[model samples]
Target chain A: MEQILANGVYLGAQYAMIALGLTLIFALMNVLNFAHGQMYVLGGFVTYTFYGQLGFPFVAGLVMSCVTLFILGALIERFLFAPVIRRSSRDESTMLLAAGLAFFFDAVILLLFGEKQRGVPKIVNGVFNWDFRLIMPYDRILICVLAILSIVSFILFMQYSKTGRALRALAQDRTAAQLMGVNVDRYSMIGFALGAMLAGLVGGLLVTITGVNLGMGGPTSIKAFMMVMIGGAGVISGAIAGGIILGFLEAIGLAVLSQYGDITYLMIFVSLMIFLAIRPQGLMGKPWG
Target chain B: MKRRVVLKSAVAAVALSAFAAGGAWAENPVLKIGFVGVTSGPAAAWGISNQRSMETRAAWINETGGYTIGDTTYDIEIVSFDDQKDPKRAIAGMEKMAQEGIHYVVGPNVDDGAAAVRPVAEANGIMYFPYAFPKELYTAPASNAVLGMVANYQSGPAIYKYLMENKGVKTVAFIAANESDPLSQRDGGVAAAKELGLEVVSDNVTYQVDTTDFTPVLTPVLRTRPDLLVLSGVSPANAPQLIRSARELGYQGLISTETAQDAQVLQEGAGDLANGFISVGGASTPELASDAMREFVKRYTDMFGEYNDESNTKVYALEYILETLKANPAAIDDVNAFQATMDGFEAPNPYMVGDAKLRYVGSTSFGQKRQVAVPLVVNVYQDGAFETLFVAEVD
Candidate 1:
């Protein structure tokens, strides 16, 4: 049971990080941002190149991954998303554009890095012997701590800061916030960059544990999207709740099912169906106002 | 004017005929070797190694003025198509090679890819050399196909024998991919373990091919506290990850696998954790290899920047193939004659193990002799390097 919970916490922290990014994007821009996962992968590769390949300091690589991906996200918003979002078929064009960007990013990484699986050296190697039956790895502890800190910091910012409040107001009521002199365009860019930076940071951190592969972005996107939908598509708190729920469920399923651990997907889908049937707006999502 | 025109015409006709004759006489007979395998996806390492090794081998042969048979010398060339580890893509790649009149073919390293391309190669009467270990590939519709390495059945017993004897392994926790090749591997291990008086603590653990996190499966296996963990016929792509996960979870038991050939990749994945892991094939150290194999390994690594899995086997097989070509030059045009030459051929072993001869396992069910019985050695990664231990002949 402790082992199962350990796995759940490890997996859930990653899910929460990814889902938070997705929710932040949706909250700010009302775009699904399909390319979000690709940004995550790009960040991983960047860290792999810097720390794993170039032999830089691990913390430097981590910082560079966030800064580089944040800048990239802002540039993408400025040049690609902004132009596409203004067109008559804004939603359709933006979705198509994001998908295209995802493919482009995957192809670029494939060309640059080749198809081999790359591993980043763990920041903290080996387990810390607790003398108990349960063994705890330092990496897992670091992951949980970092995830909680990021979440709390973001929440605190949204509650207190002028920019964060404006972004929250925009998420709640775009027209009213605009009438009250909130710059929607600038907030959208900032929100996308923040979301992308979070994804990048998680990717860099998780690559040490999961390893990085060219095809990882697709799976990461699918899981994060699943979490977002389960948590209520645009709900911040819902994403966290949804991620933890899915993570624990998957861990428990794998523990019990053993070889047939693939059945976790079916379980998750069934739970999603039941949840939708019971409450259409997700666990914490507001109904269409 | 008529006399001059006739003189020019006669000169042009003679030049044309002479040019035609020269073209025919100077046309060097070429031996085309085709490799169809996964070169573009997650399992790209396997196919890439195949390509790089074969290319190096061919380049070495070509540099020596090619293989001579009768009064003809043929330039050796390798043409490869990437299948991406997909069955349909493998078949398409095989078909493409066949269309290009390539008679000699090698690889689709995975079982399904081999299964997909085997029929196409056989139908086209191509000389197929497969590294995959599925029994179905060696069974029906096998025309000029030869198993280049030890099959699952052959390696399993050898692997377990080494563990039970050399490593003093008493109990094993077995995990294999739930597929035909691996299932066969599991059977071999079980039979060998039983015969050798070894215990299987948990014999029924299997994982899907795409499973990345092995903690869930290893959690239960580690509880049994077996002396050895057997990951037979698992993809090379997954073996390192699984081994690393087991280590991360504090399972200190010895990990052994038959399908892991590339120690470099495993080391990269597991870092210091890869120590004490056992795998089949590969020279334990540079000193264990023959002079020829040492040179080949040096050249291969210097060129590609990585050590290939079973470098000795690849070089030996290529040399054997070259010798077979020398014995039957006409085999190029007639694949049956080529098959017969390979079937009847014998040579001294060119690997680290002495007294082991290059031979074949003639299957009565397959109705023809295919599959070369190369020397099977058990290797362990100790102190961040591979150390070769026991050497056994493939029966």
Candidate 2:
């Protein structure tokens, strides 16, 4: 039972880190950036290039990955999403466009990186002894710390920063916020960029824990999407709640039922379905669509 | 009337010259050989190495004035394609090669890729010289044209029996990737255990392809308290994880895997946990101190700069194929007849594990050899490196 909890907590931190960016983007833009997962994978590859190939420091690689993706997000918003939003397409079309972009980026990644699973050098290599019997990797503890710091920093930004206020306003009512002299377009671009940066941060963290490959992004994106739906899409607190709950469920369920059969993925889906059917507004009373 | 005569004469002249060129080209009769494997993706290293080895052998054959059949010497050309480890791509690659008029082909190095190419090779009457473990391709609803140069999965059972009888391992457990192409072959080890009257305590299957976390699977097996654990997988990455996780969960027993990749990398990853692990493969370690083996290793390392896990086996096998062709060139014109000659030919190839002699079984479906006595070496991780425990011939 302790082992399951330890595994769950480790996995949960990674999941929350990944979903944090998605939640930020949806909260501000009311646009689900389906290409988020591809961006995460791109960040991982960039880290690999910086750290593995160029022999840069691990921390520098993480920062470089975040900054690079931030710029990419800004460019994408200006060139792609900006025009689409201006044209006023149906929501379905918008969703399809985002999904198409996700696939396009995935293929591009495959072409660029090939399909090799690249391992990252460990940043902190030692097991943490937790009183008597429990032991875990110190690196996993670092991940949890990073997640908490990120969530706190995000909360602080929203509460105090002027730009953050403008983002919140836009999320609440884009038209009213535009009337109130907020630069909606610029803020939306910034929001997307921030979201992408967060995702990149998560990607770097992930490589330290799990090796990165081309196929990792899709399943990760689905998990993040599930987190978003369960936590309430636009609610930041809900994202954290959803991530932790899902992580715990996965850990506990795998511990109990793994011997019987491979029911880990099935259990996750069943939980999501039950949650959606029972509470249409999600955990936070925030409607997803 | 004069102009019309001129035009008719010109047309006749063109037709006559075209026919003459066609006849000249037709008299040459070019035979094409196709090579297919995962030339890209994570597992591409294996495929690329196999292709290079095949090319090297082909170049050597062609350099020696080509393969002579009867009174004629026809040059051998290898037509190669990248399967990328996808089944659909494997089929497409086979069809494309077939369409390009290749009658003989080599590879589909791994099992899944071989499975994909098998039906296509059979349909086109193309001889597929697969690099997968022997039994995988030959044991099924057999195709005479498909030949495998590697040792069979039954090799595992042979190794296990030797270990149990000699090394005193009494209890065994089988753990394999659920989706691995050779997952069924784990049964070979299981059956061998049963035959030897060694306790077969558990059979556990983990998810295939990308298994990052093996803890959930290993925990149960450790609880069962088997004296020895056998892992069936290709890479060191998976093997180390299983070994490390097993150790973390407080299980101390002998651990063994099939490939040298696991033996080397698992030690690096798991440190002491990888100690005492033994595995079997087609190639002997370079440290064996045999003159022929030493020379082979030296040439390989000199050419490629490092000893690749399976490259020696593949490269030498290709050389064996060329040597066979040289000895019996007449067999080239008629594949079936050539196969017969290969069956009858018996010269020990030092490239195989045990200075093993190769002979073709009369059964065409079974390829060139029904069995080759590749020597299996038992290695233990000692003082941070793999040390040979025992070397024995596994027939």
Angstrom error at residue B224, model 2: 3.0
lDDT (C-alpha) at residue A222 in model 1 = 78
Error of 2 at B174 (Å): 3.3
Error of 2 at A60 (Å): 3.4
lDDT by residue (B93-152, candidate 2, tens digit) is 999987986656777876777777878877876667665654646653555334444343
> CAPRI band of model 2?
incorrect
Could you list the chain B TM-scores for each candidate?
0.84, 0.76
Kindly list the per-residue Cα lDDT of model 1 for residues A177-202, writing each as its tens digit: 99999998898888888889988998
Give the per-residue lDDT of model 1 (tens digit) for B120-211: 88789777777776666676565666777766566667777766776788998787765656766877777777777888888776765545
Best by DockQ: 1
